[model samples]
Target: MTVHTGAPRWWRATTGIAVPCLVAAACGVMLWSSAAPVVDFVYFMLAGWALVLLGIAWLVLVVIGWFRYRTVRRTLLAPAVVAPAFVLVTAALVVVQAPFRLGFLVSKPALADAAADCTYSLEHRRIGVYSVRSTREFDGGCLFFTQGGLIDSVGIAYLPEGVPHLGAPRHDGDIGYDHIGGDWYRFVERF
Candidate 1:
């Protein structure tokens, strides 16, 4: 085996210690930032791609170091493996979580209002008539309105066959039709 003796002690120490630490720190920062609501989806996508590329490059460096330097191979190995793995995992998570976060970001205001109305109607049981037609964001459905203009219960159908339109009770006491694949309105609900 060929020995590499010209390398500086500081260089070996920095590569062995500092690089891995920096990579870990960067991964932590990326993970923490990705969870922030204010960050845009586009930013996440871009950052994810960038991290993936960086990981790939770091992996290449690790392979080259393994072949070229006997003394420093161990020094270069840990960061080379761990950094890329951490970065790739973080990138994947950020990409996967983007859609749900974007959905919340773009959710229609009408859905929020309808959900609030449904909650109030259900809790008070004084419903009269309540309904919300499905939008691109939320499923279309109707709720039963009791005598006191409060909602009694809610039923929503996901992606109904027809185009989305406002639906009201056909008659004063009508609770409206129930459909499948939709969620029942709840007081505290997530998107």
Candidate 2:
């Protein structure tokens, strides 16, 4: 019986470094996208767990590679480096997401207040009501009211400190006003 132990040089190099590098990049993108609001909540959650799992899998592959090919120690470095990179990337993602989550929490009260004020008025007398809706499409939080409502508007709020320039609420449509100076905005639909 013959036992095959050595892998081809190219195979070892590709698997050791190239594959791990690709995986790490993918994991980083997933984590980043998950945090940046490009992906939905379910995808974000899945990507987060996938990153962790990929890190673990890379570590395991490195260990297996280390044992399988005694001569290709250099190849094992890929996964070795990738495992920690994954962890760091995931940590960074969490750190980046923390503020957004905190901002959402902080802004909830303001949103509720705005919704209440917009929904009720002496003249309109509760013709309609503003309701809290998922802001996933807008990448933050929003309160929306329908037409003929006391106030038909979409209110968007961001982190008070780190307002994202890219996804900031549009001010060109309808009658827009700054609800909280710079961090919050409301766009009232034109009647």
Candidate 3:
């Protein structure tokens, strides 16, 4: 059996802690700055910078440990672990956050108008019309919208004719989409 020892142990522990923190920091930067419609470029830049930092940290540790212990490289220097770990974490992050990010972008146009509707009548749960057309499947509470400052949420329950463009209302206590003239629209929590 092999075990991490001496500097290699410290190096591995430090990298393990830092890698997650760097990833989380990158996600934070992306979410916080991504509200702007034009923030895609900036978000990419921030992500790239974060990746560079991660790579630098990893490389520095590998090189230092490789020169110091020599045996460390044989055990820890596996591209299979590094590459697959990176891909898995990245995929997980994207899959988890894609809905919220897409929802934010889609609703940005209606934000101002939605905010305005909240002041005069705040008693109503219904906001306004919402439209959704997706090539991907959505569950209950998938899409959210805001109108006149009022916010509402809906989701796609069914797709008739196997068409993503055509969705039907659901009774699962969630809003669904309707197809009208090849377009999807949600109105007042109904399709």
Candidate 4:
């Protein structure tokens, strides 16, 4: 076994640390995109930018690592292993909609309580984990609306009777309601 002498920590990091970070950042971007409706859009965009910066940092490290350790190994000069793993994991996430499903599960209870408290109120309020901009009662459940962006909004509704446009992905040009599961449905409007 050939020992790598006079190698800087960053050189090792190209393979050891940077590759893993690159894969993680990619996964984060994917998961955040799926969960964006329930999360703060500002933070989501910021996270995307941060992930871009991380990818750039990893690329720079790999370039320097390759020049310095030209004779070391090809593995250090590329994201060979982690890249394929990222692809496979991303495919799985897309197939299952894991993040969106998880966001629904985690935010459901808090949103249910918020809906209960907003029956007669129209003012902005923070109830438990979710912020409610407005609320409306349906057949036997409630719809809680929250701002996802300046031109976009998302709602977490407990519609046991089912979403109005459950099967239709888009109600009109910019309005839509998509079912999550059970009594949970995602209400999205792009204004």
The C-alpha lDDT values of all candidates are 0.43, 0.47, 0.43, 0.63
TM-score of each: 0.37, 0.41, 0.39, 0.64
Residues 34-76, candidate 4: write the lDDT tens digits. Answer: 6534555665566556656755765666666556655346553
Between the candidate structures 1 and 2, which one is better when assessed by lDDT? 2
Residue 118 CA error for candidate 1 (Å)?
Answer: 14
Candidate 1 lDDT tens digits, 1-191: 66565545654555556555666666655554554322333444555566666556555555545555543556445644566666667668767855324433443244445545443232432111223222223334433221111233233322334323334445444434332213432111111
Worst 10 residues of 2 by lDDT: 121-130
**Candidate ordering by TM-score (highest first):** 4, 2, 3, 1
Candidate 1 to truth, TM: 0.37
lDDT of 2 by residue, 62-141 (tens): 56556665534655354446656666766676667653344345555655555444432223222112233433223343
lDDT of 2 at 180: 40
Residue-pair clashes, model 1:
11
List pairs with backbone clashes in candidate 3.
113-148, 114-147, 114-148, 114-149, 115-148, 115-149, 116-148, 117-148
Best by lDDT: 4
Worst 10 residues of 3 by lDDT: 141-150
The list of candidate 1 runs beyond 4 A from truth reads: 1-39, 71-79, 95-191
